[model samples]
Target: MAVDLPGGVFRMGSDTHYPEERPSHRVRVGAFSIDETAVTNTDFAAFVADTGHVTVAEQPLDPAQFPDAPPENLVPGSMVFTPTRGPVDLRHLSQWWRWKPGACWRHPRGPRSSIEGLEDHPVVHVAHADALAYAAWAGAALPTEAEWEYASRGGLDGATYTWGDEPRPGGRIMANTWDGPDFPWRSTGESGFLRTAPVGSFPPNGYGLHDMAGNVWEWTDDWWTSRHPDDATSACCAPDDPRGGDLEASYDPAQPQFRVGRKVIKGGSHLCADSYCLRYRPAARRPQPVDTGMSHVGFRCVRRPATVEGTP
Candidate 1:
């Protein structure tokens, strides 16, 4: 399902979180359409069977990318889930995210797993390349930071959420997120998902889009560059629609160069909670290597319609 965002002007970014999101700005975007839900296993499976597509994680890792790392690690694989037994230590996400060989979208848990009864669930363990390929197969494209934030707002400009500023209205859980004691245990089922719940299980935003804020982070076409641009302050819109920096540079000057050009992932996932990595809001963003995938990350597609002479 697709929602046509007759895209126009909207304020972008927030001061409440990362420095990259500071100094909210105004942006003008041509009208475009976007998927109402993240792409599901069923959608991608067809693409896979038809094209014989193989994901980057399914291919051998380039040793030069991790020269000092173990040569044994240079095998086909992606992030594997390791349930936390106790309080999380933010310093080490690797404790729960292991690079398991044979782990891909079809086998989310690892070589031993399969999508099985979860065909309707949003496809996880997909890297940016995998997602782009699927988008191409569907004849749709990914959204820009501006376009994504605009659609995510559900036409409620600067409202703090897709539904409203309040995280919960009238004590009802509007989206899937951690509700129990932080990380390690007790998922109170506030959003009714211990991991990723089926897409559209919760109420849709005002624009009728599902899973805009949580469930899994959706991949954007934009690479992580110069944070999100200061759209308002700049007098003119960037010619490049998806204004990202170099695929070889980081927004943060201090970060390593090899991590540059990583694609930005939006809409924090269920694993994110107050205990650590609290990136569950629309404005929250993170970068994943173009070839990295995880159980908590997925993607949605956006259709960029060509400008017509008479539509307003």
Candidate 2:
């Protein structure tokens, strides 16, 4: 099911948070319908069964892309989160993330793991291309960054979270976020999930959409940008239906040689913890390589209103 969102002006970005989300601005979006939840495993399975499509994580890496790399490291794999025995350096993300071979959507934990009981859970390990392919097959499109943020706001502009300012209001966990201490990876069980919970596991937002905050990071159509445009000083200068940065600007600065572009990803994953990552907010955003898929990343689709032949 999808939810129809009545679009209007809403403040985007945050000046008090991450540097990338600075200089809060206002944006106006048009009406559109978005999936009630993240695309579930069952939904993706149906698309694959009908279209015979294969995800990028299932295909072997091209040797030409890494001519200097070792042969053993050139296997099909995706980034999987592995908890540490105890607390480690929080600055180094490699302490918990592992490149596990054969860890596709079908085999979430590796070649041996299966999705037997996870049919309702949001599908993970989907690269940006795979998400676009699924959206095309479903006769839908990936929501733009602006559209996604607007919908995530759920009619509460400038709210800290999808539900409200408080992340866990009244000692109640509203989303599937990492709740406990960061060392041993313990969950508070407030959302009854450790990694990715079933879609709609929590209550819906003002727009009747569920899992808009935490579950899995969702892919968006916009490219990655270091910062957003400054807020307009007057109504006449306000932007409408803004896109994102260009392809050249979206590349990873650490790897200048690699020309692969990155797209914007919205919504924090269940791994988001208050001790470290506090991105489970409406204005939060991240950058993801178009060809890379991880265990904590997934996506949803959106549909715009139809237009007549001569209608403007």
Query: lDDT by residue for model 1 over 1-312, one digit each (tens)?
Result: 898878777777787777767657777777788898999999889999999999877889788877887878788888876777776676777767777899988998889989888788899988888998999999998887777888888888887777888878998887787776556445666666777888898889888999898788889887786456555445666333446567656444556545535777888887776666557666777877776788888999998876689885
- For candidate 2, give the lDDT of residue 185: 54
For candidate 1, list the clashing residue pairs, or say none: 247-261
Q: Give model 1 RMSD, 1 decimal.
A: 2.9
Badly placed stretches (over 4 Å) of model 1 are: 68-71, 231-242, 251-260, 307-312
Query: What are the root-mean-square deviations of the candidates from the true structure over C-alphas?
Result: 2.9, 1.2
lDDT of 2 at 298: 95
Per-candidate clash tally: 1, 0
Worst 10 residues of 1 by lDDT: 233-242
For model 1 the TM-score comes to: 0.90
On residues 202-249, what C-alpha lDDT tens digit does candidate 2 reach at each position? 988999989889889999999999999989999876688899999999
For candidate 1, give the lDDT of residue 214. 79
Off-target runs (Cα >4 Å) in candidate 2 are 188-190
